[model samples]
Every structure is written in C-alpha cells, then in structure tokens.
Target: MGTVLITGMGRGIGRELARVLLRRGDRVIGTVRDERSISGEWSEFLASGQLRMLVLDVRDETAIRKAAAQVDEPIDVLVNNAGIIGPQRQSTLDMDFEGFLETLNINTLGPLRITHAFLPHLRRAKAGKIVTISSRMGSLSYAKADRIAYRASKAAVNKVMQGLAEDLRPEGIVAISVHPGWVRTDMGGTGADISVAESAAGLATLIDRVACEDSGGFFDWQGDRLPF
Candidate 1:
C-alpha cells in the first residue's frame, strides 16, 4: 500500500476517492478547507493513523507550504481535486470577472501550487504520480460555450499538466489530467449521468495502473485516452 494525497476531500468525488483508497489499504492524506469538512465516518481511520487531514485553501501558497512541511513521508500519488464550478454568470458574453478569476485560481492554479509545495515529498517516492482531476468539457474539440469560465480554467490546467509531464519525464515522474465523467455531485448536479461511487471506482483503478507512457496524456475515468 502507498500513501496518496488528495485535495478537497470534504465531499463529492474527492471524498469518495479517499474512501476507496483507504479501504484498499492505502494511506490517505486528504485536504479540506476547514475542520468542519471533516466527517465522522473517517474517525476510525484518522485514529488508526491510516488517514491524515490537512486544512488549507489551495489558493494560499503559504498555507499549502505549511501543511506540506508537516508531512515528512513520501507521497506516491498527488490528486488535485479541489475546484469550483464557476459563477452563475459565466457565459461568454456575461461573465463575472472577479468570479472568473477565482475559478481560475482554484481550478487552474491550485493544483500547480499544491504540487509545487509537495514536490520534495513526491520526489522521495519510488514512482510519484500527479493526477489532476479535470473535466471533459474542457476538450478543445468541443465547441460548447456554457460555463465559459469553468471550461477555460480546466483547459488551462490540462495544458499545465501536459507541460509538467514533459518537464518531469527525465526524472521518471508521471503527470496526467483526468475526466472523471459526469458524476452526480454538487458541481455536476443531480441530473448527471453517473453516481459518485461508479466514477470514483473507475478513477481509482485508472490511477493504480498509470505508467510513464500515460504521462502528458488525458484520459477518462475508465482509463480510455481522450484528445487534449
């Protein structure tokens, strides 16, 4: 079993992913925005030292660094899951500039910041992997205009992950962006196609088998390749 760090484990996909990993005997280091996000279900795991929780906003670089300092062990996987769906007024013509910026900060830049803060710990691992939870809506082939801010932010982050994969290739580190499917979550809404359990299970299996060749590529929850 390995240690996996997941951001935004308060609820939804991130929480589910943490649960799946922990149950499979992998140590989980989950991050939430605050103490209130902590769930009573995780009490046993936390007490057993199988789970570690870090409270920090991904946008705050200082907070991320401080949290990273507390973890001295190697992290096998870093899952960048914390993100926002963007403002209600996130259309191409009608956009809330401030809200758009916040979306970019959380969705696009947050993963990079967290990855940077935990680089040393990841480097200590045998084969560190960076998996950023991105959306298929960001695909360039799709000309969809809905939620422009969210789409733009995800697209930007995908590019960032690709670049990271290239730069870290020589070191044997793997980085890939993932489309977690239309999961039924707060962000995905109730009408979404798949349940959280289904999506999370697929994601966990996909993450388990990622190799160096998978780096710089984008894949869905089912481990199928997608066009970037």
Candidate 2:
C-alpha cells in the first residue's frame, strides 16, 4: 500500500483515480480548492482512513508547498491532474486573453508548481513517481485545427513533464505523462468515448507500471506510446 498524492480531486478523473487507489489499499491525499467542495461520500473515504483531503488551488504555489510540508507519511507517488478547458470553444482569434492565461495557470503551470513542492518529499522515498495527466490534444506532431489555447497549454505541460523526468531521474524518481483518452467528464464532454472510471482504471494501471526507465515518455491510457 503506497501513499499517493493527487491534485484536483474534487471530481472527474481525479476523484475516480482516488477511489480506485483507495480500493487497492493505497493511502490517498486528495487536494482540492476547498474542503467544502468535497462531496458527502468522500467524507466516508476520509473516515475510513484511506483518504485525506487538503485545500489547494492549482494556480497557487504557496498552498502546494505548505500542504506538502504538512504530510507526515512518505509519498510514493504524485499525480498532477488539475486542469481546465478554455472558456467557450472558439477560434484563437475569438479566445479571451485572460481565459487563455487561466488555462495555462491550471493546465500547464499547475503541474510545475505542485511538483516543485513535492520533489523533496518524493526524493526521500526509495522509489518515487510523478504522473502528469496529460492529453493527446497536446501533441504538436498531430495538431488539429481548433481548440488552440487548450492544445497549446497541454503541449507546454508535455514539455514540463519531460524536463521533470530528466531532473528526477538521479533520485530514482520516475516522472511520466499520461493520455487518458477523451473521457466523459465536465472537461471531456458527453460526446467523449471513454468513461472516467474506464479511463482512470487504465491510467492507474499505466502509473503502476511506470519504471525508472520509462520516466520521460508519454503513454496512453492503455499503456501504448503516444506521439510527442
């Protein structure tokens, strides 16, 4: 039973990942913007002692560091899953600048901040891991026409994960990014093909198998290699 820390755990893929990890007997430290945002059933998870909730906004680096310091148990894994879709689907010309910046703050830059906070803690563990829940939409090699802002932010996230994989290697810390498919969620939309449960389960399997040698690559939910 490993101790895993997950950000953006209020809902969607993050919440599902927490549930699956807890079911497998892993201790989960779930971070959200606020504790009140946690649902009733989640309280039961906390009560059961497999889950702990922390208040943290992805955009806030201060909170990430402070929370990391509060963690007494050693963390075996860190999952950076907090992200946001750009406000309204529009062409790049139509996208608001502030909205675009917010997307970067949450989707790309958030992982960097959280990972920085947890790095030392992870290094202390014998074998640590960091998984950034990335999107295939980020692939510069396979860029599509629309959703420019979201796509650009994810691309940035991909690079961040790659750099992290290199930086953490000497410490025996594995860092990799995951493509969870187009999951059905607030972010993925109803038209998406995969359910959050299905996607999270696949991602957990991928994360579980992330060895040190696999650190700087991108993989899909099914553990197949994804194009950069």
Q: Give the TM-score of candidate 1.
A: 0.99
Candidate 1, residue 47: the lDDT equals 99
lDDT of 1 at 67: 99
Q: After superposition, how far is residue 117 of candidate 2 from its true place, in Å?
A: 0.7
Output the lDDT of residue 210, model 1.
Answer: 98
TM-score for all models, in order of appearance:
0.99, 0.96
In order, what lDDT does every prediction score?
A: 0.96, 0.88
RMSD of 2: 1.2
Tens digit of lDDT per residue, candidate 2, span 86-204? Answer: 86754666877788889898999999999888887787777999999988989989858588888888899999999988887888889888899999999889999999999999988
- In terms of lDDT, model 2 sits at 0.88
List residue ranges in candidate 2 displaced over 4 A: none
